[model samples]
Target: MSETNPSDAPSPSDPSSPDAAFAQAAELQRTGAYPEAADAFRRLARETLTLNVATNLGACLIETAEFDEAEHWLLTAARHRPTEPVLRRLLGNLYVEMGQMERAEVEYRTGLAFRPQDAGCELALAGLLLSLGRYAEGWPLQEARAGLNPGVVPPVEVSFPEWQGEPLDGRSILVWYEQGLGDQIQMCRFAQELKARGAAHVALGCRPVLADLLATAPGVDEIVPAPRGETVRIRDYDVWSRYFSLPARLGTTLQTLPTAPYLSARPDRRARWSGASGVGIAWRASPTGFNARNKNVPDDLARRLLDLGATSLHPEDTGVADFADTAAIIERLDLVISIDTSVAHLAGAMGKPCWTLLPRLHCDWRWLRERTDSPWYPSMRLYRQTEVGDWTRVIDEVARDLQARSAA
Candidate 1:
């Protein structure tokens, strides 16, 4: 969860005022001192159980993983202002963190009922539904993601009409990249589907780092590099769509997902990394996000994979320039063991054997819930955390499975 800004806190004319206390607590919360913030909020709650205090306390409790207490305070605030959509979203987020997905869905829907245009609530519901494999309902609601503050969908300006399941026979369609590399890698498979449906050309607008790699994706006729600080204009396509929107437009369900190797390492690049063997491991996701801490395996815990003869696949360690190099390395490896990150997606896209480690909190919707296998990647296995902030059990299981596979 992103930190809540303290600027919204009530200002006090006097230092000793309750308003001043609230400001202090809010600042602590904003600065990520959750335990201290929770303590301050608890004291304020004892003095007066206002909605502000209850809500702030609830958020802090959630950061500290005090789910039961968080639920109590959040529900208390909700009871005070039952019509507040924000409170319902908070409750929904809390339920998701606690693995109470059904309750999360209820809270999200209640928020939407109160404010039908609540983008955050809609996005939350979309994620929950998709995680539960209710794709038909989830995909439509996911469009609200663009309406969010600090929007989840990338901003783009183009003259071409947005594709909405229109006929593409002998016409061009541009699949513009959105979100992260992993997202593009996973969704690029749709290019083949578009081709099969008779699109004359499938063009990808993607980051330059991905240009060489995604050029090899099936049905791709053009690579429009989306470099930073430069406007990308591809007026050639008849229609354009965000990469993620393809599933919704195509009416994709779990069973109908295009699960095939739509990407390949260049023959020369694969030959360059032919010496690579054993397990290729990535224990960390991007280190600069709110969810990074939860997604990353502790260095000490990850070193256990090294003991099992796994080699690190991190770009920093491997001195690789781009994903093409990583794909080449993965092509030569027997298996890939990674956290939920781009490497896992790249490996899965290439139909390589991959085992993805999933965190209990804020796990991506693509992995779905309580499943050891992925429909999106037929050759991939999933290892999920059973408890929040715990990796030992998941890693233990992976180790056992790796040993068993080797024995076989």
Candidate 2:
């Protein structure tokens, strides 16, 4: 104000100026208000053109499921700043959202070449490789997930040394569940193996919801609820390991993957749900934006299953109190029909006859591609969509099979 300098003028692109709208857009994106953020970013892109602004707009578009526009913006931005790692990562993320794995791989690799230590990009690449069944490369790169930034993951305080495939014959180990319910169910299979390998005792630090169910699991000597701003008895174990890390530690290949029925339901609960000859059905998963797209079966199909004599045994309908309750019903059911959700995992883990309905695009890595049966769960059958968002074919096939099995 002293001299009214040109540099001090209200330039549109200046951080303090009215046209500097990228900050607001970015903040909205961070808060998960994607549609609003996308609008704000679009305004910013029209007013000013910068690498950061364009990349953010592209990312917001991806979140809003406007993949074609996102590709346009990200590709244009990448051309302007070819070596910018963030832009490359953003583009990679867009490809992944669109289910374009090969293109996504290229963009992620290119970004990592410029910023080798970028944890998010590395993890994306790891997931992509794993989904393609390239476990040898994927598992090693997945270690980068532990190094992800604080914003993406909350910091975990580690009191003891991490167990890295070391001898556990004379020592106790704590296996902590780091991810979701299905992930914990799948990985808990490793505890029995850890015990067989001579860990003196194995304690599981897991979600409180699964504590009762997991207590009946074969190999866990103790079950502790995951710490949530509460003090944990971490000192009880000599060493700690992550649930998912057990695969690599155990050197699990496709051939060595364990079969199911590793978990059991309470005798009392099993007795309660006993004698149901109809199928148990789960049509929807826990609601989230990403999960909304691929993990839900059509409501009509769900109704059709019930019409075809299957019972509406989804947790929402059955008023499931816990995993134990769900397991009890599953143990009683003749078959389980589900979208890819924790229920499917539970049924499969318990060695129940389970048919999982999978989305054609962006399916989970564990399902792999174009497979009818799961190696991880010997009793599980997969019915995948023949095309994106087409649950009709999957539902028809399931209905035919159900009719055939019932008729038999």
TM-score of each: 0.91, 0.84
The alpha-carbon lDDT assigned to residue 369 of candidate 1 equals 84
Clashes of each: 0, 0
- Predictions in order: lDDT: 0.84, 0.76
Q: Rate residue 175 of model 1 by lDDT.
A: 89
Q: Residue by residue across 1-408, what tens digits does model 2's lDDT show?
A: 011101100011225445436667766776667678779878867776666566766776776668899898778777877777667777777787677778989998998998886876787787888777787777777777666643222345677777888888878988876667877888898888999888988988877889888888888899888655555555557888877678777777777787858887888787666666678888887764345556788799788888998887666678778898888888888899988888888998999989999886557778876789888899999998877668888888999999999889
Off by over 4 Å in 1: 1-24, 31-33, 149-152
Off by over 4 Å in 2: 1-47, 60-68, 96-100, 147-158, 227-229, 288-290
- The whole-model C-alpha lDDT of candidate 1 against the native structure comes to 0.84
Best by lDDT: 1
Error of 1 at 57 (Å): 2.3
Lowest lDDT block of 10, candidate 1? 5-14
TM value for model 2: 0.84
Q: Candidate 1 on 1-408: residue-level lDDT in tens?
A: 212221212121123344778778877877767789899989988887677778878877877789999999888888777877778888898998888888998999999899997887888899999999999999988888765633336676777789999789999999887778888899999998999888999999888999999999989999899886677766667998888789999999998999978888877687667788889999988864436767999888898888888899999988788889888999888999999999999999999999999988778889898899999999999999988789999889988888898899
